[model samples]
Target: MGSTADNVTKGSCICGALRYEYTGDPAMTALCHCLSCRKIGAGSTTFTLAIPSPNFHFTSPSSSSSSSPGSTHKNFTVTHESGIRLKTHFCGECGTFVAKEGAGENEFPGLMIVNAGTVDGEGVFEKLAPPQAELWVKHRVGWEGERHGLMQCAGFPDGL
Candidate 1:
């Protein structure tokens, strides 16, 4: 993807029940293995891309899903871990966790985390928001000795 400010990327939940688009590049992208991430149902950490809230928005509902004003397939689950509150949004129909927004001592207040797996595997997803770091590596399970090429942080990383 080009480095244009208006470049936009598309994403959808499994079964395409929920769709979203984020403009430009992400603020940060990282793989996380924190306890909180695991507690939320992920076996270990989550692959996330940080995008400015202002640049993210839901796209038109697909023809297969409801487009009526009364539609509500986009739902979420909320959980708190280590005093951090996070809301994981998913498609109620397919249960695909698509995005997460939260508050924590080290969380970025201005950006929201998008589960990179939900997005298209095009250049934008691979290059524009490819994980550049790993967080909470100390919480990684069996493969604790493995390493990701990105920045490594045993706990929270700076500028995250």
Candidate 2:
């Protein structure tokens, strides 16, 4: 019942106004407890999938991002001290943080960090790799119960 364009899996914003496809499997996955992540999720943590940029694409052929009827994509870039930039693309309608791009070379170079919850189907994220690391445990807000044995770090792991 899925479209051909839904190759790997179809993903969109909460409003279904934005849609894209991420082919193949994700390269890296983790739970981030950084302040930035917490703010975007409005919670203590965020589950992210680092997908290869080449495999991620907007479903529409249009040049603009608002190909969907009711949704729009907005960009926000954060520059680090090293001049590396991080661009986050989110749903303009519902403000759902969809993906993060830019010069995050230490972790997933040339990969985009996407919010796992945005993927088409529910519980699909569970099918992916279990989180191998937990970032910013120092910033963690509360107990999240038990989880897989994750390599805990104060911030982004040097070799992540």
Best by TM-score: 2
Per-residue CA lDDT of candidate 2, range 12-72, in tens? Answer: 8888866778787777778988777776767788988878889888763232754355547
Global lDDT for candidate 2? 0.71
Instruction: Give lDDT tens digits, candidate 1, residues 1-160.
Output: 3223358777887688688888877888888887766755466778888889888877755423443444534544454444556756667667677777764545556677888777765454445546788887767777655565788887756654
C-alpha positional error of residue 135 in candidate 1 after TM-score superposition, expressed in Å: 0.8
* Candidate 1 wrong stretches, greater than 4 Å: 1-6, 39-41, 60-80, 103-107, 122-125
Measured against the true structure, the TM-scores of the candidates, in listed sequence, are 0.75, 0.79
Instruction: Judge candidate 1 at residue 110 and give its lDDT.
Output: 68
Which residue pairs in candidate 2 collide?
none
Candidate 1 to truth, TM: 0.75
